[model samples]
Target: MSFNLSTLLMTIITSIIVIVIAIAGTRRLTTGVPKGMQNVLEWLVDFVYGIIGSTIGLKKGANFIFLALTLIMFIFVGNMLGLPMNFITVHDEPFSIFGIDIVTQQMINESEIIENGHKVVDVAWWKSPTADANVTLAMSVSIIILSQIFSIKYLGFKGYVKHYFEPHFLFFPLHIIEDFSKTLTLGFRLYGNIFAGEVLIGVILLMGMAGIVPLAIWQGFSIFVGFIQAYVFTILSMVYISQKISH
Candidate 1:
């Protein structure tokens, strides 16, 4: 299946909706005695804050908890949302939205066509939004940017520079390299895990429709792995922020 800009946009919109709903659902519950979904969410919040507070300080850790929660919830939900087998592939079609013209898909003589304002072509819907390299890299870049921003804001220019040359000046290049590696690892880790999970689902589909048996197994594992990856990403972000803010 082929994915288009519209589908990507829809996926992002839905992801935002999921995050907002999650936040609102758990926001007002009493903190002392969490229950139901609030219990699970509070546990996640406390766990993340605990890591940050232990590594950095209580105040900064509490401040960064919202950012951590946002990233974790968004990515986790986005990855799991891919498992639902509910979507369609059709030709790109031109349509109007809010009086503004846009192109998507349309039916053409029992076949799907993608309208390019002037013409349409058959397109297939194949994978989840997170499976796209662009989306993964964009997320990575965003996290990296946040790291820099936090560093600059908390550490100042001199302190930020000092971060790259820790221990001694002789080891500056190695330290710089090591610091940059986190960004690369963070991006690729999420991309690799999500993409591999997606590919496994595709393999199951190819085996046969009766492949429903294995689909459940793959999807279940996908959810678990997705949560792990999200946690890793959030924790790393907190770690980076703490490292920056510490010095």
Candidate 2:
């Protein structure tokens, strides 16, 4: 998939927002009672921990809680970025900066529209990073690689290789294919859901341009979908990791 500059900018902005929230949330962390951001942070931590404990077993899951939290938070924030933003399209007429002409161009979800016999460029901002296959596949590949590393750490090189031949030598290819399938499915599942959600929201906004009701409803639902996808991705990652490391 192509990497759009707009997507990169949104990703960076999402990361910064998450970092700021984390820092602010923990700055006044108190042992006695949590309040404000700390309370929200604690709730999220507990929720993630519970998911880990249920899926991968509490003892083994503890080792990967930080990774799980990071994945969920990043994905969730990225998924939510597009919900409240509006897309803007600038006319192809060149704007000058320091006497240099810069033509306006569309980035992600670009569409062409003719106005008064002239074609104008449309640009979408703050598109979800998870909506991009490249970002999702990268995350999936990272998780798969980490799973293999954990498998080797616990199972040794010989044992790791031997996992492919379990049950019979004929099953080796199937086991190898399973690894590739896991990566593909994990990546596409997340990308498809988030991308579809964004497209739907865009359609709703366009259709209901004169009214705020449709946009308001879809935004709320999209936020819920974003959180659910984050949890699903994280839990599935934990499951894959547990499977690899299990004897």
Candidate 3:
């Protein structure tokens, strides 16, 4: 399979953005008073704390605040990446970066139309990481696995295994399916929303000068949707983790 440079690029950019925000928010630690970025950081941290506390209880939730904070920030920023702008590379030949083949000659030949002697094909070079199902599903599966690990840590090996048979052992198969379902729903829910938003933006842009107003309106709405998706993903993850441990 050909590597998706856009997805990998967006993922790296998202990670760097999140890291920069973290450092900028906490660069100057002070006890006297909070000002500037410190205040913003405190508010964001408190928001995540509220989420964790409500879902898992404050005492137990303290440990997961870092994880939750990272998820919300990374996801929110990632969802917004493809909104205001996108870069498309018009490829007429094979392309690669850093020794990894991104677009191969065979791909270009198969995809490009041989019109006269010119080959033409377009590939998106930038987009939100969350816009790709591969990235979102990976995140979902990882979270589910981590939640199971948490269940084991809190409930011990026997309790963790027993969680599936809760209420009755006959439900074991149902519980297993439930885990897989959670992964699909959680991943696709975010993916569908973000990807649809991008597709709409692309359509609007096709209108050229006529799309300015609608594009602006939709971009505003898309930003709001991005934040909501990030929040929902974070909250659902915490819910999954807490519910497993509670059981």
lDDT of 1 by residue, 146-196 (tens): 777888888898898888777888889997776678777887888788878
Candidate 2 lDDT at 57 equals: 87
lDDT of 2 at 179: 94
Best model number under TM-score:
3
Candidate 3 matches the true fold with a TM-score of 0.92
Q: Please give the TM-score that candidate 2 achieves against the real structure.
A: 0.87
Q: Which residue pairs collide, candidate 2? A: none
Better of 1 and 2 by lDDT: 2
lDDT tens digits, residue span 70-128, model 3:
99999999999999898987766556678788775544654566666876766777889
The lDDT per prediction is 0.71, 0.83, 0.90
TM-scores, each model vs. reference: 0.76, 0.87, 0.92
For each candidate, how many residue pairs have backbone atoms clashing (under 3 Å)?
15, 0, 0
Worst 10 residues of 1 by lDDT: 101-110
User: Would you list the rank order by lDDT, best first?
Assistant: 3, 2, 1
Of the candidates numbered 1 and 3, which has the greater TM-score value?
Answer: 3
